[model samples]
Target: MHASSRHGTVAAAAPARGGRGGRDRRPKRADAPDWAKPPARGKQRDFKNEQRAAGGAEKTRQDTPRATTSRSERGVRASEVLRAVAPRTSAKAFEDVSRGTTVLFDDPREVTLEEQLHYEREGHVCIRRAVEGVEMIPMVKAVTGEIIARRLEAYRHRVSVLCPDARTTELKDVEECKRALKKHSQEDVGFLQTFNLHRNESSPAREYIMSKQFAKIAAELMGCERARIYQSCVFVKEPGMAETNWHSDLNMVPLDTNDFVTLWIPLRSLDEDDAALHFANRSHRDFALPYWRTIEGMSDLEGRYEIDTYDELDLGDLTAHHGWALHWSPPQPKDSVPRYALSVCYFADGARRLETEELRRTPHAEDEWSYETWLRDLQPGAVAKHFELPIVWP
Candidate 1:
């Protein structure tokens, strides 16, 4: 018999004599602690002393001057994380910007005649809040009629629907929209990005923007020595357009003075539920500081009483593109409802250069605009096949 058979026989017989069977006996372990009679398979932990020593070493390193770096160096190191996440803009161009001077206008030959007229007029200042609860000026009103007419024509062609109201095309996707963006790097770069749609310039709607009539009108309303398209973008909110996180436009356009204005024309008159725009008043003047405790939960004027309520605003927070400006609605909604709005930014002809170096040095640099794209896409001669409004500045 094999040794196993002999052992098994002995164990079976021993169990009959007493409980001294080999299978019933427990083995003694020398590798176990007093409290733990049975040793576990893994090695014991050395956590106590090692952790304390490591923590002490880290603290010592932080305290020692030899291991310390200057705040500027520390800041650069911290920003490395964001630099990785953000789309790369030309960092080299901005590096020596202190010594760098921007040509006030890139080229004079490209400046349109309408821009010249507006440039002269912007110097002659006029400020008025006209109409019932709406700011209006006679100078701006005359040009608005033409703008309304052009907008109406554009809407009919694009949507294949008619809006027979006093309001016309608030949103326009003109032919030269892409080319215009190439000129002014002010609008979308770095953290700011935009999308556009194609529209034929041969349409009557396209003819109006190219006629210099719109530029003349914009100059009068904006009260700028010249008014030019800083950026042109089209945004559509379908039945389920994603809501935008609360942010500011000023963050996109680095400016010295708050003399800039944006005209938001909606293609359709929008209702409350169909995603209207929300804005804060005069918040642009002092945006270096916080405006609201939180953007959400703010509904009525009383809710924003902590902040000055002198500046009335539309929509509290239901829509995206919430900013310091007073918000308004777009024309149409998806369920045969229209909610279209055109946002055009115009800056004064002459404004002081704001020193952006200090602002860029701030801890939160994520929201800054990038000039890299502007340098790449901007081309003077590249005219859009359809240009409703020329972007040239005198």
Candidate 2:
């Protein structure tokens, strides 16, 4: 079920206190949830350890075929890629001649489904007018306001409320929501906490929303065998927040196919005045260079801001060029009011590993360092493990 209907309640299985074994205990870290942590206890290991472990495990399994069971052999299981190819050109370079030439181009609504689907197939991304109506807007607006207040409080005043730093308020606010809910551990709080990861043992929200009705619809709409709630996130656009730079979903998990999607449900009525999130419309069709690069420079380096450089990458032009190029969340003017939205990501079943190795190697010193050498030594089987819960919302 959509988390909105189940908001403010917890499940019966929730631990009564903090800790893994309690009636409603969910994991917590400073301003972050324990669920987001690396899968292993030792957080200092590097990527080399992971590579070596992954490699070694593969080798051992190959050599002693009888030792491991079928499930054990299916490491990092997601649907296999239907095809592979040489890296293609960056879709960002294409110019849109239609921008001024066509009468229909002036009206975004006049754009046909064929145009959108064509872009989606080529670019691997697209967005549309998926929802509307005035009543829905007000409800989302109220929920959004509460979300913003909760987010602002959680940062303990760390948010900068301006460019560069401002771009990240959405992420910060999410961390805050997690912290607040984790701190209270009440049934109602737990329900709100499920905005991202809809798994709370004591979630009263889950009890009400866990019917098969929604799941069946979700699976049909999403075109998957099962629809599971993985993680939830909220997006808030206050004045001066940087337009979210261009990026892709796969870099976070490094998946193999287009087997995942994010359901973005706005909590307020969206209009021209509000900063509407623009998209490439079909960005997923191409191999998305880790969008993280634009923010962090490279996958291995700590991300630094390049506002002018990031802003200059014309998104509309790029979309027309390769179809795979797209971006969303334009910036709000310094004098304008902010917008609020809630979003969540869902992957095909068994798409993620614990990423303990990556976490282990990441330095906590808050400075630039390299994790490459460590990455080379990683063994296949040495990666930390993650387990899927028996989803029983119904």
| lDDT of prediction 1 | 0.29
For model 2, the stretches where C-alpha displacement exceeds 4 angstroms are 1-142, 145-149, 153-222, 254-257, 288-326, 352-394
Model 2, span 185-277: residue lDDT tens: 221110111133233444322321232332332333344664444344455666555445344433333322345454444443333333444
Give Cα-based local distance difference scores for all models.
Answer: 0.29, 0.31
Q: Judged by lDDT, which candidate is best?
A: 2
Cα-based TM-score, every candidate: 0.36, 0.40
lDDT of 1 by residue, 1-394 (tens): 1112210222211100111111112122123122212112122223234447687764453243220111222242223322333332322232211111122112211323443342233221111111111111221232233344444333333222111221224434543332333343222211112212112333323222222333333445455565444444344443322333323454434334445555443333222233444333333443444322222332232222111111111211011121234332222222432233334455554433223242322222222222223322222222211122224333
Using TM-score, give the best candidate's number: 2
Off by over 4 Å in 1: 1-217, 286-288, 291-302, 305-338, 351-356, 360-371, 375-394
TM-score of 1: 0.36
